[model samples]
Target: MADFNPGRDEVEDVAAMKREGDLSRFLRQQIRDGQARRDKPTAAPKPAPPPGYRPGAWPSGTSPPGPLPDRGADWDRALDRYRNGEGSDRDPCHCGACDTPDNNQTEEN
Candidate 1:
């Protein structure tokens, strides 16, 4: 068995404080601290791009290329081939014999 007490006074104090209330005061304090931290301004906004600058436009003033070509038919063909077991090289026999049942019975004669 391991010793649960790691001997951290600050952690123990916080735990004791939370236990003193129904944890409602501790939870409210956490929320208020989070909100205060978030409300503090961090950095100034980025300056706007120069006038007549088209976002993502090429240097030559051409628009960005259109969407890629559709490959749905290729995907459908691959899925169909997989479902038909076309590429599997594993042994198909579940029983001991790889041959048909008639061949097995004849060989036993």
Candidate 2:
């Protein structure tokens, strides 16, 4: 028959219980407690931290700074340019995705 070998502390505890003539009672209570523990519902796992999360980098009740607020007039001007078909005041983006022949043609042409 397979036997469960108790650890040293448990062996000592069992020996003490045996001497006190209550080893069976102690084991029955331990078994009940173990079953109770196994039957209890487990809590949900904690969520993983977000990418590049740094613990305690900011103070409690405060968060890291967010994106800067848009400059109202600058946004209005840029929106107007888009509405009027006027290109951006800044140089045209040369990224291949939106490259156009018209973007290459200058006012001197």
Candidate 3:
């Protein structure tokens, strides 16, 4: 009768090779061969800027050099223009309650 060889024998051989440090030596030799095959040292790529980096301003998490300017007067001027009917005909009135065409007419006319 022919002898039956189980799959465990192959696994046992691998374990024995690993225990004897043969596997590590084989891996080291493969790495050395790969390194020798390369002709040039590859330059590492430059790291990209962080997500919070602004072109002309400071990065996120840091405060600006001075206090921010008050924009209340700007808002008041815009509201005054809107009330004076300075917006284009296509633009809706500032008041949300009405959509009449007369709302777009300027008082100067």
Candidate 4:
């Protein structure tokens, strides 16, 4: 078995390697390689966002598709109540979509 001595200062050699050698470059290259292997960009990419997630999917950029279907009458009424502050004091539908079809930028015939 090889004898090891702690007082001889093995860390000095490591410090020398870190400073003069390409050890840092070698370590960075290894890390980049490992990441490339893990990522494997050549593999299939994730599916694009759904129709609802697309840009301008709704009148408001922030509005998400609601649990309520696009029943225009109910949407209008809800929007009216929300505008008048007749609904909950919290203003739940203030996101501008009214959780249904848009009341903004619409005309009733």
Candidate 5:
């Protein structure tokens, strides 16, 4: 079993590092190592900006938001039939064979 000392002050060279300068230096180093991190600073991560990158700024190769489509079928009679429940009771067709190529392409086999 490993030796475990619960209340032991496990400071390395505790007598030498008693004053403010040593503690301050140690804390500053720890904070720096935790934050901007001393790794090789390469290209900024995608979806995450680097240390000094600004928001609302687009990258090198991105197009602006293009015009959105005016979606949904706007036919009056077909929409009116669906709305008024006139076309509600018809059973769904599930036959494998079809007469029209367009219908075959659209409808399932």
Candidate 6:
């Protein structure tokens, strides 16, 4: 009868390697590799922004879109009423567009 070897064809099990202290050695090697990677300098730092660079500023020579169309007299009156404490929740909006009737209503014959 042949002598029985615990390892099959010279391949040792993980538990056997741990008992033999190889696990700690491998772990230390991995830790050293990680530390070396972190200590290595990264690529060149990003260039600093130009002097007086204002974040969120529109680029030079570009202006915001033209001012909104004037709100006109009706809007002014509404705003004035509100400021003078004459406006109330029940007051109808005078936006003009809403004052027009929808297509569903027809003039009575």
Instruction: Point to the candidate with the largest lDDT.
Output: 3
Candidate 5 colliding pairs:
none
Can you write out model 6's per-residue Cα lDDT over 31-96, one digit (the tens) per residue?
Answer: 999898886667998899887678899777787899888879889988887654343333345333
- Worst window of 10 by summed lDDT in candidate 3: 88-97
In model 2, state the lDDT of residue 93: 61
Error of 5 at 37 (Å): 29
Flag regions of model 1 displaced more than 4 Å: 1-56, 61-63, 91-109
Write down the lDDT of every candidate, Cα atoms only: 0.66, 0.73, 0.74, 0.65, 0.55, 0.65
Q: List the residue pairs that clash in candidate 4.
A: none
- Off by more than 4 A, model 2: 1-3, 40-109
Clashing pairs in 3: none
Question: Looking at model 5, which ten-residue stretch has the lowest summed lDDT?
Answer: 87-96
Name the weakest run of 10 consecutive residues (lDDT summed) in model 6: 95-104
Output the lDDT of residue 15, model 5: 38
lDDT of 5 at 79: 74
Candidate 3 local lDDT, 22-90, one digit each (tens) = 988877997999899999978999889788777888777787779879999999989887676556463
lDDT over C-alpha atoms for residue 24 of model 1: 80
My TM-score estimates for the predictions, one after another, are 0.28, 0.28, 0.26, 0.23, 0.23, 0.28
Q: Count the backbone clashes (under 3 Å) in each candidate.
A: 0, 0, 0, 0, 0, 0
Query: How well does candidate 4 score on lDDT at residue 102?
Result: 42
Shift in Å, residue 4, candidate 1: 52
Error of 4 at 82 (Å): 25
Residue-level lDDT of model 4, residues 8-86, one tens digit each, is 4656765766889867886799799988889454867878976566464565456675696769999899888767555
List the candidate 5 regions with Cα displacement exceeding 4 Å.
Answer: 1-56, 72-89, 94-109
Q: Residue 81, candidate 3: how far off, in angstroms?
A: 0.6
